[model samples]
Target: MTLSDASSERTRVYVLQSRQPLTTDPAHAFPADRYDVVVVTDGTAQEVLREDVQAGPVTVVRAARDEWDSVVTSMPPDAVEIVTNDEYCVAACARLRDVVGLPRRHPTNVDGYLDKVVMKCHLAAAGVPVPQAVALDPVVVAARDTAERAVSTLGLPVVAKPRREANSRGVEMLEDAGAVQAWLARHDGEPGWELEAFVSGDLGHVNAIVRDGRVEPVQAGRYLGPLLGVGEGRALGGWTVPAGSEWAARAHALNRAVVDVLGTDGDFVVHTEFVARPDGRLVVLETAARAPGAGVSELALVHAGVQLEIANLRLQAGLPVPVPEPSGRQACWLWLPVPPGRRWDAARDGARAAELGVDVRVRQVGREGNDGASAAVGASVVLVNDAPGGLARTVDAVLNEPWFRAHAV
Candidate 1:
């Protein structure tokens, strides 16, 4: 599984991206002078020209919607692989892989991960425990009686969400038929709305590296509160539970089951979440075939000594998977709230954050003119502590502070 055994000294890789600037870090995934990498971005070349490109002998192709065929036609015919780390970019990556004859998840089948209705159906067919769900198409969502019918069919207190969105966008709980109708009325004609029976349980997520059709090195964590239930401006965070613990074992098993059912191939990261019921049963919430985003990888590195991006690259490059040692330190990552016009100084806030037991800090505060109601607007704070409740208590105390109010703009 060494680099020499994986592939030849000269290889080609193409990366698909939506808008984020592409970097050259993937060069390290291979041997020195081994890879000729090309990054295909949905943005224009002028857009990413100012970015810091970290890797060389690397080419960046800014692809417009209609120019994808032309871009692929221009690539070196022997491209070994194509990859992407985004949920929205999966299909593009898959298409590129297929065009280049590289191994990847089937392009047509990616809807099993992007579309909630498709995902739940696959889970249900595989005998996986999923919340009862019904899909509402554009026609159904636009009708006046849609929500009433949905409540009649799916029952009350159901969660309604867009089938194709990420980051919990347009996800809300409807307590009654009226609320359902109101929600549908506001979202009329939008496609892919799914009404799912609410499952009350402990919310948790398992992020794992799956390779050779198996799941391993799984990490489990708990959300500070209901992730999708939070209002527009609310902040939420998660921390890693030490590996090989009781819950971690169970989560690993569940993650394996999910990958097995999905028939995922080769090496990829899976973000699977579940709800552990009070009666001791677990229900599959949803799963995505991508690395956990929003500093979860940083939490993993701090607590488990694994850099997910590097591992993912190595795996995709046909190299050995680096086994990470568990650091046995508790870690928590928080998306703190900030006002639209307010300026946040992480250096000053680091001292305040330290008082709450965040000894290790990685803070990124949003800039001005950003949407304050968006969780992406705040600082992403990573804290490390030895005590079991240290990170949790710190997060709670920080959330209780006046400046952390979710209702503020």
Candidate 2:
């Protein structure tokens, strides 16, 4: 393209983010010349803005939470604009909804999707098969009744957690009523909790770029578990792509149904996890409206042949989508969330992780029991392909690792 051609293009997009998001496998720099203006919200990426890494004219505006409403509402109509899923972001999008014409999935859709309880309830009503779970409003849960509710509704084998937590924080899997009481005591004076049926099955995940109620799920990706023992809630194992099989197909169908059922009204990206019960059933376990955490942003791009950041932009702009057909490649990502409490031997485990054919990277590393998604110290991620076929073997390897075995509670 010549200089005139480059100048002739009349498209621009603004990414609302706190930082230049980290993805281990991306080659695209921030959109520069392609966009007319890039606004840095809250000045999180001010360095990027100051250095003018962006090819075009960039403006760095530092505004606080209170000032956002007045500013966003005052924006002049412009090119394609989108924002991440945050409370302030939602308000900003609402302020500029008509003028910017962002994908319908802006702040409002994001607001609804972040709350787990609402997402579950919405999916169930939308015709998806969800686990037996109860969502509570912010009413504080008494330690005593919390136990009774678990026993009465979810029964002996159950999982409990706060509705608003991420990384499975505060999640517990209890096999006996006594266990629920003990766990509830830990909460003491916290507000509300959700008790879910303790579901056991092979875990499968889905990442989709959806707009106008139509879903383009990248594919079902399966996760290997026992990765966790009793009461552990972190996802320490890696995942595989190209989930192909009768069971995987069913899981995929369930993903579509769940997304369509709890469907967001506008353009949005969703990540959901389905548990394939041993008894030939499926349960929708986890769902997120924003892009997935734990490094899946890169995994989705590499495995599914889609650029998630760009997809998020298109959906918000009401423009054409660019998700392509699969590249028939196998890829995997591990959530390197180490176990909490137990002092696991890391040296042997790191070697074992590589031996299991894992491309290992740590997402979190802190104090033992800090990343508390499980007993794990921090989050770890694994990337691989041939997801369904290779997943089981990799999981088996993870379970047998000395580091994993040492920390098993």
Candidate 3:
């Protein structure tokens, strides 16, 4: 147990958190006692990261594109940079390459998903099924015959998402041209849209870690309930993990081949969405080269038995570990249950905070729906255990509960 013994010693993994560790409880993997550096950039996730980095000295720095040069240069020359924020994604890499250069592992064509149109094209060309998609800027698409043709040809029930959006931001599901027009108006204020042929089926997902030359499944299952999107006055409702079999296996195999074809097996994590038809066909929605946001880190650890934080640590140390087997357990990352206009006072309401582990998030106040109360927020995570081929439980536990308050104060 001696700290001097390298075998038992915890590896230095910077659970680099810009917003949060994408987990309710990051302590599950890189516990403070084991992880060396837990760097929090800025925002609610940073606050949570700071709380979780208690095992060692936590460094809270306000890092920006301009500051990256001085920051990386200040750190130990060998210290590897683990990136998190999407806004500064490109800049983070550029700064790292210019400063502490070498051995930064990331997903191949990671930027493709940033553009919805590009993602569709790539998947379609690879023979990987995806929703019929087109790039539309409203007026831009209205002007171009080709773009206009896609708009006219694309069937109803289309979902328009900004190419650069995350967490369902600026995402709108439309049934006809009117909805499309309203959505296009919004897109004018944001990035161009990727209007996709929305697939109808049971919701499900697969997140895997690809290291060296292998793609290992971390969490795969159905989305028990509804997938929430952002609204004018409130933050979008997040997704809960479910136990779905039909698409899970097929998605893993499909993603495995897709990853192989893309040549991104070197060092990275992947999150792919899918639809399971009653006929047993699996359609891939889209994939991200980076780790899945929300509380996926814990799901990867508890269900897949893949220590993403540890793997990331090993990766940072230039040491790779073998992929482990998935335990087929259900796990999730849920937001605080607080409703819009409501606020979380963890100190004054200990029982409430403990009860609603995944309800509260900090962003509720920033948008149109917020009631305007400001204090940091937190989330929760659950890991299920299964015996043999059976699943632990339905994702309903994670989605439906008094622990998660659906109505905001």
Cα TM-score per model: 0.82, 0.70, 0.72
Candidate 1 residues lying further than 4 Å off, grouped into runs, are 1-12, 19-37, 43-60, 105-109, 229-232, 345-347, 350-376, 387-389, 393-409
The runs of at least 3 residues in candidate 3 whose Cα sits more than 4 Å from the true structure, single-residue gaps closed, are 1-57, 79-91, 94-99, 137-150, 189-191, 230-246, 309-322, 332-336, 340-409
Which ranges of candidate 2 are over 4 A from the true structure? 1-14, 17-30, 36-63, 70-75, 85-103, 107-112, 182-192, 226-235, 241-244, 318-320, 337-382, 385-409
- Candidate 1, 161-198: lDDT as tens digits: 77887777778888987788788788777667788999
lDDT for model 1, please: 0.67
**Cα lDDT tens digits for candidate 2, 1-409:** 1112134455444545443432321113223445444453774643333121224444545666565545554544453444554323544554556544433454345534556677777777766777787654454455677678768987668887677655556676788888777766766566657778877787777778777667776655666554344335455543535545565467667767766666546676777777778887887877766555544555666767775655554455555556646666665555544445543445666677667666444322322334344544343545554554564565556655655443542
For 211-313, candidate 3 gives per-residue lDDT tens digits of: 7677766667555434553232222222323334544567678777657645563466666777876676677776666556555555666665665554543
* Candidate ordering by TM-score (highest first): 1, 3, 2
Sort the predicted structures by lDDT, highest score first. 1, 2, 3
**Model 2 TM-score, 2 decimals:** 0.70
The residue pairs found clashing in candidate 1 are 24-55
Candidate No. with top TM-score: 1
